[model samples]
Target: MAETEGKFDFAIDRGGTFTDVFARLPDGRERVLKLLSRDPQNYKDAPTEGIRRVLEEESGRLFPRDQPVDTALIGWIRMGTTVATNALLEREGERTALLVSASQCYPPLPFPCCWPCNNERISVGLRSHKGRKEYDLQRH
Candidate 1:
């Protein structure tokens, strides 16, 4: 009753202040766990610690002292980190992009609409974008 291990599929997301763990067992049962992204004593191992905690839950055992989950039984594992979001929030992300469109708009930009455009129905089909067959960018 204290220890269990089996095939599982897991996904991990490390946000700025939290680490989320989502797992699906071979029996079709699913679980989600969240842990603090940062601890007072250790900052570098936050993600690892969070994962270990989730694994402990999955195996129904206390980790480090108890046997860890069997990685070989894992079917798939996907993970994501918030380093990009953190960088952008801290104004340290790269700013390089080109946004171009092969389309047309009547009112033009930077102009105020008479609240008509604000209407969802009016705005949804506001753009009279022609069919793709006639789509082109000919700078005349």
Candidate 2:
């Protein structure tokens, strides 16, 4: 069996609904865990809880919820999340703006609009048009 030089490595994927964890132990053993993203009744954070579970299983010792894990034992952890994508899909966040080169073509949106330009620097200003706030992009 391949060994990990006495360190644990973990790869995690945290989505809007579920979080998955994959761990590699020092002794070449592998573990996987899946849990709910939001389970306040059971755990405060899914990734942390998952790591705790894996460590407990390896050491055969139960770790208390309030105690911090031995991070020194872990070699590395890679994590990814879909929270931002979910927020964007649902349109549940604050108003935002994007700045790009004037020569680039961007698909028009109903609320925030952009105009075609040929200059290098574009100055953007907020204007009230027909009782609605709009973005006025002008070349500088």
Candidate 3:
């Protein structure tokens, strides 16, 4: 329960460049490890190896001889990875509509209005814009 805290805990963070693991013990001490990310295979394997090494070292230091850490002695084991790569590359974002003032209303799309949605491709009303506006629609 909340009153009882785990003796050992683990948490991980996976980023584009590296994977990080953080482990803490009831003794108010912690260990951190960073590993290079591997594509396709995910970034957990590397951190797992790192955590194993840390556990071994801690076990040796605490017991002096060969002793296994009891499961109950561990607090929590957390793992996570960053999976935003696809979304970043695809540029797939929220679906929303843009409202333009009457002065700069035009088929926002690069070319003329198509069909179906006829979704405004590109609208412009700003005077700073190089393109024509509603008033100069006939100019260009």
Candidate 4:
């Protein structure tokens, strides 16, 4: 095993059955580690343990129990998930909301539209709105 001191970049993928890690050490050496996913009776630590094991292998020392891994030398770490894909495949993720345009109702208005008197229930799309706001909302 070659040892170097500087910075490192790593990527980790945590899947349902395994965890894979790829790291680039300071000495320009590439390291790879794969571990089985595990969830004990009360703790889910597969991803974390996998990273730790990889780091230990690269550093040649067991990480301290009280302190976190030195992240300063870590250039970047990216994470991803297949939860949405799995949800779609399994027919899950049903929590969703639909936005109804006020103009889509009965008669279409040509000018600025006025929403019905539902002061207590109004959702503002912040993504579509911006700038300072100074106005009073009243149900009319």
Per-candidate TM-scores read 0.49, 0.65, 0.43, 0.53
Predicted candidate 4 versus true structure: per-residue lDDT over 24-137, tens digit per residue: 777788887776666575235655665566577777877653457766656767665565556655656643332335545346432233344332455443232265443433
User: Which should have the higher lDDT, number 1 or number 3?
Assistant: 1
Q: Write the per-residue lDDT of candidate 1 for residues 68-134, one digit (tens) a residue.
A: 5456656777889887657755656443221223143334433222122221322121223463222
lDDT of each: 0.57, 0.80, 0.55, 0.58
- In model 4, pairs of residues that clash are none
- Ranking by lDDT, best first? 2, 4, 1, 3
Candidate 3 colliding pairs:
6-75, 8-75, 104-124, 104-125, 108-121, 108-122, 109-121, 109-122
RMSD (CA, Å), each prediction: 13.3, 6.3, 15.4, 12.1
Scanning candidate 2 in windows of ten residues, the lowest lDDT window is 108-117
What is the per-residue lDDT of model 2 for residues 1-140, given as tens digits with 9 covering 90 to 100? 23347888899999989999999988888998999999999999999999999988897878887889888878888999898767766776755565545556555433343344555688779988898787666667
Residue-pair clashes, model 2: 0
What's the true lDDT of residue 32 in model 3?
Answer: 89
Better-scoring candidate (lDDT), 2 or 3: 2
Worst 10 residues of 3 by lDDT: 131-140
Error of 3 at 43 (Å): 10
Model 3: how far is 22 from its true place, Å?
A: 1.0
TM-score of 4: 0.53
Which pairs of residues clash in candidate 1, taking residues 3 or more apart in a chain or in different chains? none
Best by TM-score: 2
What would the TM-score be for candidate 2 when compared with the true structure?
Answer: 0.65
